[model samples]
Target chain A: MKQVWVFAEHQAGQWTSVTGELLVAARNIADQLNGELNVIVCGDQVEELAATLKQWKVDRVYLSQHPELNFYHPLVYTETIVDLVSEYGCPEMILFGATYLGRDLAPAIAARLGTGCAADCCDLKLDENGNLLQIVPGLGGTIFATIVTPFHRPQVATVKPGMLETLGSSENEDKAKALKPVEVVKVEPRFPQNTAAIQLHSVKQKPAKESGLQAAKRIVAGGAGISGPEGWSLLEELADVLGAAVGATRPAVDEGWASHDLMIGQSGKTVRPELYLGIGISGDMMHTIGIKGKGTLIAINQDPKAAIFKQVDYGIVADYRSILPVLIEEVKRREG
Target chain B: MQPLQIAICVKPVPDPKESTQLQINPTTKTLVRKGIPLVINPMDRNALEAGVKLKEANGGKVTVFSMSPPEGELTMLETLALGADEAILLSDLIFAGGDTLATARVLAAGIKAQGNWDLVICGAESFDGGTAQVGAQLAVLLGTPWITRVSHLKRVDDKHLLVTVEDEVEQRELLVQLPVVLTVESVVNQARPLSLWGIVEARNKKITVYNADTLKLDQKGIGLDGSPTQTRDLFAPDASREAEILTGDSPQQIANQLLDKIGWSRKGAAN
Candidate 1:
């Protein structure tokens, strides 16, 4: 039987949402291919995580416990997984969350195994021949391309968060009964003899600040129409009043007006806030694809005929510079 | 100061703004480019800028390498105008339709043919391919350490470099030695515009073209037939979100109406 594997990612013992998201995708693909779903979690002391995986639809859990893996090392992580794949006769397909670790490790592992890997894929499915079809946005999300690894064994792809919904049994079930029973297996840790070649001196950490774009319920995003760097401050003021995060289009980022982390697009982060307010931004497909919010969309642009109006729940035809201050006042007045 | 020898991999892609003109070949699964104009891929320009600045700071030679069609030589000349000392184009019909892995193989071969390479650089990802695989694959092929999305070169000496890279969550500063492959991030440095004088100087520079045979790569694993991955199909995505445009007289009224539509109450979220 074909085997489907997901490289479950975690940090400091907590599971990342992308891991659950990939589980959903792997489950569907496994069902379609009549394959067994397996998950590999490598970290220091991953017993709790392995136990949690037992409740999911996973059939096997490969846990590699080691101190060196507490934090992800590119060479160490890639070598650990690559060794497992070779020992298990190689799975039919492997999926990874398009997070930093996944992005760094997927290509290297594929290279070591002499296979092909598709990166930042949004969709996956099994073709009639049971080959994996990887769909990714190309040309900055202007067009979508369907990639297939016909000749390569164990086709690999990395999917971004919020792109796929998590799937399993109903939410009412207890943890163990949530899905199928899983067999947990422990694997010996592997390491290069001379690991000192790539020395990891220290990991300087940013303050524990979650990006507003990722955690906020509402987001006020801007684009080139904001004029220049000075415009972002105004948007920031409005976002503060609304208790929302500040997001920007690709142009705003490329122009150096906004930092890259604030960008919302195909090449940037995907967001699903309850309310997405875009001002002075044309609704380019590149930006729109990243916006998968369940709430209302309000597009404010001077061009009444702007493409953004076509995809908005509320369209304000006026200069955002004129509208922002007024909107901030109204929201503040309502708050009072 | 020891002279630095750098090899940069560049790809020529259709102007992303004119992406509306891009088409796909149903049979070959490759891009159909006939009338579309091409330019150096956006991020590759950043890599080139990094290379140029490195050479300028420390006396060295920066060579631009690309595996593309014969027309790519024009783009390489433009790169020379951007500050590369010389340019090499690996072109042949045999190299057409190669995926990232196949593309990286030819690049590794090209970089190997030129002896005494201290560093190799590439863009984090191409705007067209969006795979971001070649640099990592090339690093594996070259048997060297690699880093991607490098935002800045904090310090550089003859044998090592201290670089900062942006990750999904935070910024990480790494101390890596030379004989490394670096895929630079977009925000590393602003790519300087081509100067008129630089363009004139490029007229005297040499652009060496090499066919697949010149690299002496195993012919069986070099091109479309050898590419492990294939395209099943290419098509536009299904439109998922259809929005309704709201009409209001004043900005305040629009804000109030929007707040109501989303069911935001004074107390908290009401949805």
Candidate 2:
């Protein structure tokens, strides 16, 4: 039977949302190919994580536990996955979330396995020959390209987070409980002698600024049209009034008006907020691709012909500076 | 502490500012990159700057390497202008159409032929491919420890370095031994602007061109034949969502209409 694998990425003893997203994508591929879906969990004490996989739509879970595996060591993790594949023979495909750890691990494993790895793919589909088609944005996010590993056995891809949907937790829990328990396999992890060359001395949590773009319900974004620091501060004010997170176009970030973490586009965060207000955005596909959420999009631009107008639910043709204060006042009046 | 030896790998990518002009050859399923000018991949400048700064502080040499067609010579010269001690271009017809793995293999061969070095640096990813794989793959091929997305780096001693790596949620500080590969983030340092004297000096610097024969690379393992990934199809995405233009006699009127339409009131506030 064909075999498909998903790397279950977890941090701080909780599964990242992308792990659930990967499972959803992997489950579809497994059903289509009549393959067994397997989940791989590697960490210091991840038996509970492995057991939790029984409630997922998977056939088996492979757990590799070691003290050194607590934190992600690139070489050791890559070696563990490569050894597992070698022991069980190569599978048809493997999927990973395009997180920092996933991006680092997938490529290293692909190099060791002598296979192809498509990074930050937005979608995955099977071709007529059952080969995985890795869909990614290209040419500065102006086009979509389907990449294939025609001759490689184990197709590897790191999928972008928030691009795929997952089953609601309540619905999934009920359905999964009716299915048979997934088998768990334990593997012994081996490390290379040179692993000591890179030693992690400390890990510090990033300051919690601009942290919730992925899960935010409302977002207010700015583009080059916002012009300077004053305009950016105004944008922050509007976001604060609306209880929205601040977002920016690549140009705005390039202009040093916002941090890169607040960038929304093909190369940055993919946001699916309930409502998105874009001020002075020209709406390049690179930025629009990240905003295809089910939301009420409103754009304010001086140019009636701005590309952003065509993609929004409501567009006001005026200079954003003229419209912002009026809108902020009207919102406050309604609150009063 | 002896002076360090550093090697930096760079790529000449199509200028991202000219992205609107980039097109796909429908029949060949490839990018039609004739008119677009090439620039050193943006982040690679950070890597080059990091290397140059390290050399400037510690008194050493920094070499730059790239794998591209002959057209890439201009980009290599730009690196020399930005303070690379020397540059090497591994260009040949046989090395065309390679993916990340093949690219890393050819780079590994090129760097290996140049003898041993204390450190190798690269941009975390390229703007065009955006795969972010070659550095790690190159490190694997060279048999060295590798770190990606290094935001801060300092020389602790001749044999050790202190580096900070950033991911999505946290920053990790690592103490790494010498003879390592580092793929740096753009935030590591601002790349220095080119000076007139640097350009003049660059004109006199040596840019060695090495081909497959000089590098002694295997015929079947350095190009399209060796690359595992291939493009099956390419096309623009459908983005034809027609928006409703909100019009009114004045700004206040339009604001009120927009608010009412979206049901933004005290009772229905988003928060």
Candidate 3:
């Protein structure tokens, strides 16, 4: 039988939402191809996490646990997956969330396997021949390109997170009860004793208060029109009032007003929030493609003909400087 | 300590500022790059800058490598102007239209033919492709340890270096031995501007050209034939949603209307 594999990603001892999202996406492909849906979960003491995959419509869970697997080591992790593929026959397809780890690991694995990998794919489809068609925004996000590895087996793709829906808990429970018990395949991890090439000295976590842009319910984003640092502060204040996360365009990041992590665009994070407010942004498709959610998009720009206005649900053709303070006060007044 | 041998890999990408002008040719199923001038991928400048700085601080030679068409030699000259002691351009018809894996294979051959090196540096990702795959794949082919999204670096001793890498939720500090591959983030350093003197000196700098025959790469492993992935189709995204522009007498009035449309009230705030 055909096999479809999803690499379950977890961090800080919690299963990332993208892991569930991948499982949901892979399930569709598995069903269409009449294949078994499998998940590979690698970590230290992650038996509980691996077992939970059974409830999420997976046919099997391949667990590789070791002390060295706690944190993601590029070489070790790639070697582990390569060994699995070698032991078991190559699956028809392998999917990963386009997170930092996925971006780092997928290509390495593809190179080792002498195959191809599509990066930051937004959609996956099956061709007539059962090839995985990796869809991604291309030509500065003006077009969608369908990439395919026609002659190669085990077509690989790193899908963008937050762009797909996950199976809900109730749906998962019902499916688990209907399906047969999931098979658990435990594999031992082997590593060379000489890891002195790279030694982990310390890990400092980011402040927990700053939530990821992908998970934010509302996001207040800035662009080049956010002329300087003072402009970012104003946007941040509005975000604080609305309990929203702050996002930025590539230009804003280039101007050094925002960090790269908060950038929302084709090359940065893909966000699907409930509401997205873009201030001083021109709304290049390169930036707009990342806003995949069907949320109310509002743009505040001084130019009446700005392209961003065309893409947004609401546009204010006035200087953000003139409108921000008034809007901030109105929001606070209505709340108080 | 002896000076380090630093090798930097760079690519010439379409100018990102002019991205709106970029288009895909439906017939060819490829990007139309006729008029857009090519510049060094932005983050690769950080990689180049890091190499130059390392050479400036310690006594070392910085060699730049690029796999591009003949037009890329001009971009290589710019690298020479930026303080790379020498540059190598891997250009040939057989080397065109390769994916990241194929591209890495050509680069690995070029680097191997160049002899011993202590370090290899690349931009975390390219501006055009943005695959961020070459550095790690090159490391695998070269049999060296690799780190991506490196934000900081410092030499600890003759054989060890301290590297800071940006992870998903944390920054990791690692101690790595020499002869490592590193893909640096744009925040690693500010690239120095080109100088008139540097431009004049670049004319004297060496830029050696290598081809498939020169590198002795196996047939069916260097270009389009070697590429595993192919573009099957391309189409513009659906842009049918016309925005409803908010009009009002004043900013306050407009704000209230927007809030009303979005169904935002103090008592009903989803937050």
Candidate 4:
């Protein structure tokens, strides 16, 4: 039986949520193919890291250790993954997080290894012929794509976070175990010379007054209809009353009315909050990507055809301008 | 400063905003292109803008190159208007339905035909294909350094330049030298508006069109034959909505109902 492998993602001592998610996917594939599941963790604390994944039903773990890997160097990580995968022989499949580092590093490793790495896959399974069938979003999430790697060693995929739910450990208890040690080629590389047209300075963050959107209990999202920066005072009024963090669409961000961090869409933050209230925004797929997992989504847009309506569980087809003040007043009256 | 030979890859895209009747035959999902309006992919505007900015800073030429179906030349005028020094519409019988890899191969040929230049810039992703893989692939094909998700070009020195990449999970800044390819993220600076002079210049210049023979491209590599993947389908999603209008006898009641619908318990939600 072909084996399954997951590249564990983490920063510092904390493991990434995607690590848990990939384990879920690994468990599913392992159950389906009746295959052994393995994990590869690259960092200084290899033994400790391998021990952490043992409880998750991992059949074996490959720890690639180096003090140099404390921080990410593309080649340092990619080369490590490439060398490890090659040494492990061909597994039926390999999975990684479709995060920022994965986007750049995964495919490059795949290219270097002369294999296909399907990017941003939402699901993965074996086809009738036993080839890997991958599910991915196409054309900016307009639709889903089923990609297949018919001819390759270790069919590869990068899966998105929040796409799968972590299963309870009890259901998958006995199947998980850490593996014996394997050879990890450690390469000490001189950092490449930097030459880009932008400067990345350390940003001084404001002290925690309220939570950022990801951590916020309530979110007030201003849509395109909110107009310019000056018009944001209205949203500010509501956000203040409701103790909510403010968010916006790409258009709102492009208009310079809000900081780029506040924008939520396919190209922006993926937020899961207790309550998400969208004001005057059309719900396009890009915008929808940010708020799907929220507990409740309330949309206020004038256009019936606005894409935001379909995504929001509760939608009001009224002018946000006319309704907002009333809503704000009501919120304020109740707060008092 | 030496002139940077900048090449901008433009794609002729279907205008999705137009009342697009993109209902594919349910069984096959291929786009019904018999009536879709064609325009330059909107993200490509960033490439055009970057090309213009690079030319302004480094005193160089901007070449607008594209491979598309018949009548794709319409965008050449727009490209010229956007300040392309020259426009080469690689419209050949063999270049039809070229996927990203094949298009890159065709584009690589056209780029090679134009001789060496300082840089190549493309949108990190296109609205049409949305693969965002082409720029990286092109860089590999050309054997150059590839930087994806460049949001800003902050500074440029003799052999090095500084750029910021808003990579979401982590924003990074790097300084890289020339002979590198950059994929402009959509979140980057909005494309600058074209001046009237640019429009007039584009109107005045004749767009140069090339066929397969003119570019001397291998027919196999320039079209669908070279593409490793296929678009199994392109169909509008079946819109599904479970809807209810919170009805009330009065406006105040409606506000309360709306709040209730959004899960705002009157007292509990109050700050």
Candidate 5:
């Protein structure tokens, strides 16, 4: 039988949410191909985490535990996975979450294995020949491109978080309760190598106010319409009341009104929040692509025909300057 | 310390502000390259700036190379005007439709033709391509170590450098050895604008253009033919959406109505 593998990403103490999503995605593909679904979890003292992975529909979990693997060292992690593939049989498909590590690691693994990898893919399908079809947005989400890697084995793709939904555990629970028993096989891990050249000297977390935009549950974003610091201050007041993170359009960042880290567009961070409030953004293709599949997009722009209005769930075609202060007051009153 | 040999990769993309003018050719599976003005990708300017600063501090030469149409020579010249000592343009009709992997292979070949280099720099990703794959692919093809999302760098010695990389969660400072590739983040540095003296100096700088045969590039390893990934279809995404536009004469009335539409109440606002 063919095999589908997912790189179960975890950092610090918790498993990233994308891991669960990938497992759900992998299960569907594995069933379609009548293949075994497996996972590779690499970390020090992560056997307990590996055990948790076994609770799912996975056929096997490769737990790579080494002192050097305590943290995510790019070279060591890539070498470990490559060694694992060489030892065991190579899978027909590999998927990763399009996180910072995934973005940095996917291409290297693809190059090392002499295969093709589609990065930040939004959709995946199988061709008649069983090859993977990677659907991506190009030209900053202006167009959609369906890409295929027909010649390469173990077709690889890194999917952005929130693009795929995690299959509920209730179904897995039922399967575990009935039918054939599933015992998740745990395989040995490869030894970590090549740790001398790159040294991790220090890691500094950003202040709470400025960090975690991608992982935030709520966001208030501004665009070119937000003229200057005063406009940002208005957005900040609203954000403070709503307890939402702040993001910006490319032009806002270019104009020096906000930092690059807060920029949300094709060139900036891709955000998927429960509530995305775009105060002044016009919903250009570049900005829209980053938040394409987000949950609820509420746009406030003066132009009734702003492109963003077409993609939003609720649009308020009024001047943000006029609407913002009132909205801030309303939110404050509600919170009180 | 030995003079550093830095090679920066740049791509000329249509000005993002005028992106509405771009069109995808259905038959060719490529952008309709006409009339739209092109500029050096915004992040590539940051990478070039990083390269130039390293050269300025460590005493060496910074060479830049770009793979685009012949019109891209102007972009390469602009890169020279920014601060690079030499510029190379890889352009040919045959190299027009290559994807990121094929482009990386061509760049790897071009970098090899330029002799030994201590370091290579590139932007994290391009706005048009939006694929942060080239630097990694290029490093793998060139058989060198690489680090992406690098925000800061300092030369520690002839053989080593200090780099601060922004990972997903935290910022890490790393000590990377020579002969490594670094893909810089947008926040790496503020790109320096062109100066009168710099533009004057660039007038005398050499801007070389190389084709397939000149770089000794294998025909099978470049352009659409060499690319492993193929774009089967390209089309505009559906923009039609069902959005309810709220209306009210006053800001307070509009705010109340908007709150009602989004299923939010005064009590529910408590986060």
Candidate 6:
């Protein structure tokens, strides 16, 4: 039987969440294909990570220790992974998180091995023949196309966080398999830095708010119907009360009510959060696509027929002007 | 003194929101070539903006290099309408489904086929895959220096150019010498709207399309087979998470309930 590999990604000092997500994915793929799961941790102070992974079904853990590997040098990391995987010969597949480090590291190694890489994939599965099948978005999440590296060995993919279910959804026992521990120790490497000198400077601008859109656990999205800057202020107040992010629709930006960067639609960032609240926003399908990723969506719109209603778990019909500020005050009062 | 000649790369992509269909060859299940209406890549619009701006500022000629089917002609003409001086399309049967690397190869070849260029500016990453590696990979293929995620161009001259990159840490304005490839992100400069007169000119002028044999590309480097990466499978994310709604007699009560869920015990702590 073959094995599957997950590259444990750590940068500076933190073990990225994608590391566990990728490992869970690898474990899943291994289970489906009747293969063993092996995780290769390359960096110092990764001993605890090895044991932690065992709790989640990692059969064998490979720990590579080196001081220089502490900080990422792409060339060094890529070469080390390639060497390790090559020695293992034929792992059914490998997984990496689509973080900056994984994105930088995966392709170079895939190229060296002359294998096909499906980068930034959000999903993966095994075909009837146990070949790795990958699901990656095309045209910027417009279409999810299926691809296969039927001829290649160890099909590799990098996936974003919050997309995959690393652990079993309903499997509560946390049952897993642990095999013999394997470790790799390589010399610290000094590779070339593309830019001549790395420069550092601080911005005089005030620090970012407690919750930016990317960091927010909850988000309240408004649409063009909100009409003016006052609506934004109202939304901000509500967000402050609940500690949520504020998002806008395209029409809001087109009308000069908010910055385009904060717009939620096909053209903007994909946000996934615990709670998504919409106020005065007509649910155009474009805007609706961005909200389904949330835990539960509570949409408020005067237009009962707004497209967003179809996707949300709950809906409210009213003019946002009357509801938002009062809701904020009530929330604040309750907290107080 | 003439400003350096430039060729900008662009492609046609489908809008993500629109339902798109591929023309499939009944026999092989491969995408058929005909009847796919094309639009300029959402990101390449930014590349065209940078190209036109460079031409206008430096008094240089802007030529667009495109790789697509014969329909790619429309994309080039659109770029011309956006103020490009000329446009060329590389339409080779062998150039289909070429991933970033292979796509970069044929594009680099297309530019090389045009003789010499002082600078090549492309959209840092296309919207389709958002790889952003094509610009850097193209630079490697051309054996030139590449600066990516460029948000601003400070100055441009014969010997060198300066641009600001949005590095992970901070704003880095680097003075990279000429004989380099620069990728412009959408944030860099907004592509201008096409004007009536420019549209008329673009419609009237013809675009040149070069096939595989015309470019003399290695057969191994132009199509799906030529690509090092493959599109495995794609499906939407499971947007499912457990949500606990707060129930309270009043708005204030609801707010308090939410604060409790967020693990903040102190009332008024958030404000």
Report iRMS values in order.
3.1, 2.3, 2.9, 5.1, 3.4, 6.9
Estimate, for each residue in A1-336, the C-alpha lDDT of model 4 and write its tens digit: 678988888854766877888887787778788887888777776566667676566777777777666545554566567667666677877788877666766666555554566777656677667677777665545566676655566776788776666766665444444333433333333333431222234322233332387667788998679886656888878788888899888779877888877877666666777778888787666666666453777787778777767766777777666676877778767656
Per-residue CA lDDT of candidate 4, range B1-271, in tens?
Answer: 6777888888877785752354444543434455777777877888788888878887889988888766778777888888888888888767765655567777777777778877788887777566566776666566566777778764366555566774334556666667777888665667877789899888877677777787787775556554544444343333455445454565566677787665565565732
TM-score of predicted model 6?
Answer: 0.72
Could you tell me the fnat of model 4? 0.18
Error of 1 at A41 (Å): 2.3
TM-score of model 4 vs. true structure: 0.80
How do all the candidates rank in terms of lDDT, highest first? Answer: 2, 3, 5, 1, 4, 6
Query: Over the stretch B1-271, how does candidate 3's per-residue lDDT look in tens digits?
Result: 6788999999998888787688776765766776888899999899999999988988899999999988888899999999999999999988877888899999999889898899999999998788888998898889888888899988888888899987668888999898899999988889999999999999999999999999999968668778899888887666656678888999889889888888878754652
- Give the residue spans of candidate 1 off by over 4 A: A167-173, A177-182, A189-195, A228-238, A317-336, B16-29, B32-37, B53-60, B154-158, B169-171, B187-197, B248-271
In terms of lDDT, the poorest run of 10 residues in model 6 chain A is: A197-206
Lowest lDDT block of 10, candidate 3 chain B: B262-271
Interface DockQ per candidate: 0.47, 0.67, 0.61, 0.28, 0.57, 0.22
- Order of candidate numbers by DockQ, starting with the best: 2, 3, 5, 1, 4, 6
Considering summed lDDT, which 10 consecutive residues are worst modelled in model 3 chain A? A188-197
Model 3: residues with Cα > 4 Å off, grouped in runs: A170-181, A192-194, A209-216, A229-245, A259-261, A302-305, A325-336, B248-253, B264-271
Best by DockQ: 2
lDDT of each: 0.82, 0.88, 0.86, 0.69, 0.82, 0.67
Worst 10 residues of 5 chain A by lDDT: A177-186
- lDDT of model number 1: 0.82
Whose lDDT is higher: candidate 2's or candidate 4's? 2
- Report model 6's interface C-alpha RMSD after superposition on the true interface residues: 6.9
lDDT of 6 by residue, B1-271 (tens): 3476877888776543342454334333244435555677766788788877767776888888888877677677888888888888988777887877677789888889888888888886664557655665666567565666677774544666677664222355567766777788777877788899999888766677777777889978668888766554434434343223345565445544544554444464331
> Which is the better candidate, 1 or 4, if ranked by TM-score?
1
- Model 3 per-residue lDDT at A193: 46
